[model samples]
Target: MSFQWTFLATFLYCELIVVIILLLPFISPRIWQKFFNSRLAKAFAAGAKYYFNFIICVFGLLFLDSIRELRKYANIDSKDLSAPHAEAHARMKQFRSQRNFYIAGFALFLWFVIKRLINLLVACAREMSAAAEAHKQAEGATRHLEGVMAKDPTKIDPREIIASPNNPPRYVEAKEHEFEIKKYKQEISKAKEDIDTLRKEYEQSMKKYNELQDEHQKSQIQLAKLSDNESSKDK
Candidate 1:
């Protein structure tokens, strides 16, 4: 469970990194001025260059065109600040490819998760329903056998053999009884397995949700720090 949560957290981190990279052009310059004297701006400029280049390389042709456009916007914004626009511009010129890979990928992944949950719930419900139906069938069979026996004469009767254990109803080898028990056991086991699977998925999802919450808090803190630092500089 712990290992699974760790892997989920790592996946969440990659997702965040991708989102931040995609938003870099729109967010970075607004947070930092173009002036060379601004230390944070220089770091931001360097990171922007490295980050976009890295995206072009790693994501390759799949995200080429969208990335190029993004890089172009970032370059113009960088130029407004007298930052290294040429490097970003040059990369966009060199690599001409485009895809909204992240948006599509994220959406597909979400759809998959939703689809899986829907499938699991539907299957579980069916299993439980089958189990209930089996129980009803078995009860009905037993009740029928009891009624047949009660109608028989407890003393001497036409079909009742005095020495026979299953005298009248003779249910021990009845095909219906065997069938009922077999069907009930099978359905009940299936229902139990489905219930266990549902529980595991719920637990994993809960853990993932908690990890996401922690990551969100950390990002909020970082944003707060940026705001505080800006304010303190003015003061």
Candidate 2:
């Protein structure tokens, strides 16, 4: 085999190994996800699309060449077949071309399959992680609701807040309404307190203004009296 063909065969073997490893039952999606997310994998993934496309194109060209060669050899001249050595050589060429065709074709097919399997495993891992987080949140909420119910059983029932085995909608509209009403009441009370504080401040400001006015009036009267006495003394 030529160097290029040998390289292709090696690549095909590597792909086959990878597919086998991926299909192994003991290897979980989580492990695959971690490997794919690693720094080394990320660096490769950055150019993986272009790299895979280049490889596919090369394999496609090789496959086409193999097909052409196979067809060329299949139509060997009758003169060539008359010679036994020539016939055997032509047959050998045809077999090699056939082998190359299968190699390139399988390699190309396996490339797509490997890409798809990796994507599926990564997606599965992410979905599993999300599901676990959701379950944790649900459990925490259930525990909190249980605590709240323990304090005030009449206010909220556990069944009304938490979903049952059938996964019914948690009917908390009444509880939400009550909470809103209580919040509004607190806001109204706060507004009233602010209004009372403002009213007291306004009253104090008016009192101060009145005191200043009285002082100004008394000063004006004293100035007038002093002016009249000075005028009398001059007279």
Q: Give the worst 10-residue stretch by lDDT in candidate 1.
A: 28-37
Q: Which candidate comes out best when scored by lDDT?
A: 2
Residue-level lDDT tens digits of model 2 in 37-108:
999999999999999899889988988887887787767687888875988888889888888888888988
59-174: candidate 1 lDDT, tens digit per residue: 34433434655566544344444555676655554343222434333433543453344345456556776888999777766665665677644332332233455644543445
Would you give me the overall lDDT of model 1?
A: 0.56
Angstrom error at residue 157, model 2: 14
Minimum summed lDDT over a 10-residue window in model 2 is located at 152-161
Query: What clash pairs does model 1 have?
Result: 34-81, 64-97, 64-98, 65-97, 65-98
The deviation in Å at residue 123 for candidate 1 is 55
Clashes of each: 5, 0
Give model 2's TM-score versus the native structure: 0.61
Residue 156 displacement in candidate 1 (angstroms): 12
